[model samples]
Target: MKSSVDQIRERFDNDVERFSNLETGQSATIDAPLCLELVAEAAAAATPEARALLDIGCGAGNYTLKLLEQFKQADATLIDLSRPMLDRAVKRVSAATAGRVEAIQADIRGAELDEQRFDVAVAAAVLHHLRSDEQWSTVFAKVFASLKPGGSFWVADLVAHQHPGVQSAMWHRYGCYLADLRDAAYRDAVFSYVEKEDSPVPVMTIVDHLRAAGFVGIEILHKHNCFAALGAVRPITGG
Candidate 1:
């Protein structure tokens, strides 16, 4: 069985220090620094005047903190399942911006987000924890509803491929990368943890859900191995 929300939360609560770094980001993710840079840049380009930021699964606030460098005046709302993670994120993010920093200790699946309140939203190294197609659809719609007109939502996360051969190749490549990062034991541990804790969908599945959620201008920011960064803009013309 997949790890429960409580199990996931506990793991992250103890791992805040690893995620706190702004330079490297969460090292488990392939091209972690690159995705962080890409997502922040793309969000800035899409919403240069963004004044309100929502960071789902904010971790130690790396993604929000990176974006804050671009949107210095933006208020930040950070959500995470781990209170320790939230506390760390709030502390770091608050130190970076004079604007308001709100930390929400709750699963994004159940977090209540106000509609039309945010100019940009980011979810990095998250979303893969979502277990069902319905949950994915609901969360995507929630993010869509929470954005102001022209607001954009960005995601950087582990992604599964639809083709079996491609999936095997990517998984093998990711395993090799992890092994190279540390050792075979470390790679095995990570692989075992992911198998128990994650349920990622294909990048196209995410795009389809984004479209169904009323997002436009969907763009693939980057893709390498089993990870991807993507974004979509909420239409300025629609409700």
Candidate 2:
């Protein structure tokens, strides 16, 4: 029997054809190169060369392609709930990494990673689909375990505003942004889809989950209205 999570995964799978188009993903922080630029700025010092990366909810290969482009020889493991999405990501990264890339079709909520180790783990615009905070915490813990000690982790996603006024403002602004980008009917449909299928938390709550998962030196790399990019490292001493 299909679970609720499965239904959400299926919906994302249905969008696979349009998923690869970068423009469809535009938002406050969805720009492909801009996201890595934020990561580079946050890192300041360069990360180790040829290091491995774990990409959670990779979708149709947007972030993976950019990461490989920026970090030559970096290996990547891409995980997503939808196989169709994973297939696209696999083809996208296979040539770039030359056998260094692995793609897995698995849901983050319960998926267990293998012997692969990663220097950094990142997810883009993906976590809001998780049904609850518990699932989010689980994803963090799993990513923490997957990384080598002292490894980095980052995420770019939509965040829910906590205060009533702030939430109202963000929602209205996002609606306006969508309307400007697309049409009014499209904006309304997008809003409805978000309300029904997504569960976004405030940015601090994400940091709290990362801390609970044993990450240190947490950084809020970027936030624009309701979208944000946050990153941190697992303690080398395994704190």
Candidate 3:
């Protein structure tokens, strides 16, 4: 039996472009230009003294590259669990920003995020991958602690619906629709990978978890069916 991580990597490696394109179709991807715009907006909203940005679960540096493009002055840290994903992101960042971004490979659940703090933290297409409510809480708490007072955390991923059956139907439809556009082998790999036994957490629960972790002013900035972007601000007084 292959480990879940290995299986995921194999699927990704087999059809990176197809997978990227499928992901790009999501609200998070469709809202990429807008999201980057919002990040700039958030960065501007922060005190002028704050300039660093941390991108949690920065797979393939999609958002990381956009952030650098949108805000040339701000430095960014790209964190993810997959080394190959991080490597790709590093290359993308280097090509786009001439080596202005940093990359770190570690699980966001318990890894020490270094002493470095950021003015803003962004997690796109993540959160759902976490296996438990406690894991979600732990990651959010880490994000909260990694930020400066009044800093912002922007999170984007697939939101959970009230009806699991409806959600499953939508995912199946979308996945099949996308797979049709790609090669058969690639499509099978993606479908097989997604149809795993243990599903990840839903999006609404993640928002609740974030609030439980002490974030304030939580709101969904964008939504496209199950895909959405959410954000909250760290309290100005708390550690």
Candidate 4:
């Protein structure tokens, strides 16, 4: 069975220090630091005049902090499932940005975001936890609703492959990367947790969801191994 939400929260609550570093990002994820930079730069380029930011599953707020460097005057809203994670993100983000920081301890699946409120929204290494198609659709739609016209939403996360052979090949590569990063034990542990907790979808699936969510100008920023980063903009011409 998949890990329960409470279990996921408990795990993150104790792992704040691992996620606190902006330099490495989540060490377990492939090209974590690169994706961080990519997402931040892409968001800045896409919404150069952004004045407000929303970070779903903010974790230690690394993504938000990076974006703050670009949107120096933008207020930030951070949401996460673990209070400790949220607290750490708030502390770090507040220190980095002169703009106001708002932290909410809640899952993205059910978080109530105000409509047309933000210029940029980012979700990093977080959406993979979404288990069902409906959950994915709902969260995408909600994130869409929360952004202002011409706003953008960015995502960097592990992604699945539609073909079984391709998925296996990617999974194997990811496993080798993990083993090389540490040891076989570490790789097994990471694999075990993913099997029990994650339900990532393919990059194409995400694109379809974004299209259905009313986003335009979709762009795939990066993809390496099993990870990918992408963004889509809400059209200024539409409601």
Candidate 5:
């Protein structure tokens, strides 16, 4: 029998196909190139030889494609809970990477990954959907388990604030401003999705989670508004 994570992944796969085709404004700009720049920077800093990379939640293959371009020698595995998203990504990266990029439709929370290890693991804009602290802990533990010694994990996500009033107000204003410029469908889908799952956790909590999961050398590499990039490394043997 498939696990709960597997069931969630099946649901997510269906939703992502709808989400990807909905003409949502956020889907267009809030993707790989912009997000992976931060991740690549963090990965490079953590290890000089990032020859193998794994991208968790690799929707539409954007970050995986960008990583291949930036790190020519790197082989990437792009895993997502969404089949349609993985299908799209596989098509996009297959040519340039000569099938060096593999896209898998599996939940990072519990699905079995390939036995081969990676120099870096990246998850961008994915943690918020986990819905619980224990889920987050489980996900981080799995990510930690997948890495090679000295390998790093890079994450970029929305950071929850202690005083959410100001940030909430700003997000409302920003949504309104964007609504005025974009089509109604675009605005509605993007804004509605963001608002529905706006329950973010503190950035420090994420850092702490990584540390508790046996990661070391943690650092925040980038920040823009509520979105931030943080990373940590697996310890070298006996150290």
Candidate 6:
């Protein structure tokens, strides 16, 4: 049997039937609008137009759908580990824009993404899947190398709180968000799965890693409980 991380992809592939009750369908967080601002900033700085966007861990393609809408002329190269999610992404994004859309069903960390290849990169609720801080840093560098100068990387994810009392408060809110379902066992199972598979870290660590990877002008776009969005830019002049 596959481990939880492997199984999670299969579950996402089956998400169409389960999305009604899952967190996957939730709207973007309050700080998400700031991500759009960063995207627009990248667009304005690009030579021709902001026409090449990359989406990492694009589960079921929700984030890509938003990018397609925002840049109708931009093409997308979406990377994910699950083939089912990639297929679904293609179907959802194909008709929405005239720009080219391609899916690479591979792990983004080892994928062959060319340097200066994209104008903007987006990742949502994805980095927590990496098993360690080292792996997280590697993925950050991979993304940093994949962007063009002046390109920006936008990420939305859950992070670990540095303080224990604050951590409890954040978990309490996360639990409350699911409390309406009123299925204690179901909620417990979900969190148990998360505890076993997810390796979330403080957003500050990510900021440091992005800086080491050559991202400048970094900012935290928003924070709500444990969930937040962050934006970082690859400077316009660098090798």
Model 6, position 214, has a per-residue lDDT of 86
Candidate 5 TM-score over all chains jointly:
0.79
Better of 3 and 4 by lDDT: 4
TM-score of model 6 vs. true structure? 0.85
lDDT of 1 by residue, 1-239 (tens): 99999999999989889999999998889899999889889999999999999999998999999999899968999999999999999999999999999988888889899999999999988899999989988999999999999999999999999999999999999999999999999899999989999998999999999999999999999989899999999999985
Q: Model 4 off-target regions past 4 Å?
A: none
Worst 10 residues of 5 by lDDT: 19-28
Q: Which candidate model has the greater TM-score, 4 or 5?
A: 4
Give the clash total for candidate 2. Answer: 0
Please state every model's RMSD to the true fold in angstroms: 0.7, 2.7, 3.8, 0.7, 4.5, 3.6
Task: Judging by lDDT against the true structure, name the best candidate.
Answer: 4
lDDT of 5: 0.70
Lowest summed lDDT over 10 consecutive residues: which window, candidate 3? 19-28
lDDT of 6 by residue, 107-146 (tens): 7666888878898888877788887667877888888888
The candidate with the higher TM-score, 3 or 6, is: 6
Over 1-239, each residue of candidate 4 has an lDDT whose tens digit, in order, gives 89999999999999999999999999899999999999999999999999999999999999998998899967999999999999999899888888899999898988999999999999999999999889999999999989999999999999999999999999999999999999999999999989999999999999999999999999999999899999999999875
In angstroms, the error of model 5 at 26 is 5.0
Q: Residue 142 in model 2: shift from native, Å?
A: 1.1
TM-scores of the candidates in the order shown: 0.99, 0.89, 0.78, 0.99, 0.79, 0.85
Model 5 lDDT tens row, 31-75: 324556767766777777878888888776656665676667577
Estimate the lDDT of model 6: 0.72
Q: How many residue pairs clash in each candidate?
A: 0, 0, 1, 0, 0, 0
Model 4, residue 220: distance off in Å is: 0.6
Q: Which stretches of candidate 2 lie over 4 Å from their true place?
A: 1-3, 22-33, 40-46
Q: What's the lDDT for residue 61 in model 4?
A: 94
Q: Give one digit per residue, the lDDT tens place, for model 3 in 1-239.
A: 32375565454445334323323523223355565556546545643455677888777776766566555667778887777777777776677664357888776876777532787788876666677777887888888888887888888775657687988886766566556666667666655654562244565787788789888888767766556677888888865
Question: Which regions of candidate 1 deviate over 4 angstroms?
Answer: none
